[model samples]
Target: RLERLGARFEAASPLGNGQCSAPHPLTVTALADGVALEPAATLNCRAAEALARWTTEVQVAAQKEFGESLKSLALGGTYVCRGQNHDTDAKLSEHSFANAIDVMAYGFTKRASLKVTAAPDGTPEAAFLASARTGACTFFRTVLGPGSDAAHGNHLHLDLRERNAGHRLCQ
Candidate 1:
């Protein structure tokens, strides 16, 4: 499926540290049509698939909002062994299992890049970001970004954390 989406990636070594693990991990460098993931991303296949699917929506939103194609994604992180929100006593984060991605910014083919910070109201960047965040809920079980919390104010935190009764958290 990833190949069908034109995503360039390769299988990675199994990852784990007792508390967190990914049996089948992947390192993705690009999405559809050469849309790069800046610095690439290390993720479980399920998370990578969700990202691949969401990129289509992002491309559409970019075209509609800025009349430009997406060039690259400035990613903040993919897999990290840490507690949620960096609190040592909190539950382990989806990133701890290679099942989450932090997106820091969006790069365009013909427009200035837009960071995932608060954009002015009514601006194209704001609308584009809103569209991206909302669209992500369709693919990711958890979609957190600016306004969700101070910890997530500068990046979109997407994850595939399962929940009771198929509930989703899109904040």
Candidate 2:
């Protein structure tokens, strides 16, 4: 599906903790003439389903905001980290169950990382990050941005937290 749309895909780290079937979202980038998918740990059934929904929404939002200019997605893949915003005790995060995807970073260089949330002033990175935030609210339940805390400074936290649980945070 991605290739047909000129998307590039790559498999990244796989689960090693011997937990579930290596559940985590495959980080992807869909551009105007090419797409990139960095396959990460592994995604559980629920998260996988949620990602599908999120992907669709992201595409529409990018086009709506950029107009035929599919913003370059640069954040390779979701990191399967031990939970906790910041702490060694950050045990298996929701991502361990493939319930979360950390958008480490994105690329608006070819375009413009909109000014929103952390940026708001229209810095290049900020603008790109903004589009992700602006468009993805409906796809994933929890969206955490830079001001969300030190742990999330460089990434957009997107999680499939059902029941509207946890912090519906946007930093």
Candidate 3:
């Protein structure tokens, strides 16, 4: 049986941090059953459909642009504290609920790889990130790579939640 990871969104709180209006936290849960399954997020049910669609697109793009040699995908950022750039109030993370995804690794089997913070910065890492960002996959509504921000120096922040419906502040 195939399983689609489902995530749920929880409104951001101000108790931890003064910022909570950004992407809400997500609560992801796994379901096991017998059925032809498809990958899915636990974001808003409506948004989940979109997220699932986009995720597949990103995978395809990665393979097509990077290579069929690509293996497991690495993650960096996911659900985090929603706020303006660099604004933190010591609150819970936006991913506290599971609304976000941080890409940190991408291995081509146990051999070739493209993992953020996995290998020291060099020509290989540079090329990996460059290709992923420029590949133009429609899976993630937004893709934040190195140079996007210092905090993102080692990974790509992939959010599959509602954007513009409110706004996208991730980088």
Q: Estimate each model's TM-score.
A: 0.98, 0.61, 0.50
Ranking by TM-score, best first?
Answer: 1, 2, 3
Global lDDT of each model? 0.96, 0.53, 0.46
Off by over 4 Å in 1: none
Ranking by lDDT: 1, 2, 3
Flag the better candidate by TM-score, 1 or 3: 1
- RMSD (Cα, Å) for all candidates, in order, is 0.6, 5.0, 7.3
Relative to the true structure, candidate 2 reaches a TM of 0.61
Q: Which 10 residues in a row give candidate 3 its minimum summed lDDT?
A: 31-40
lDDT of 1 at 128: 98
Off by over 4 Å in 2: 1-34, 39-41, 76-81, 107-117, 120-128, 163-171
lDDT of 1 by residue, 55-80 (tens): 99999999999998999999999999
Question: How many pairs in model 3 have backbone atoms within 3 A of each other, for residues 3 or more apart or on separate chains, i.e. clashes?
Answer: 24
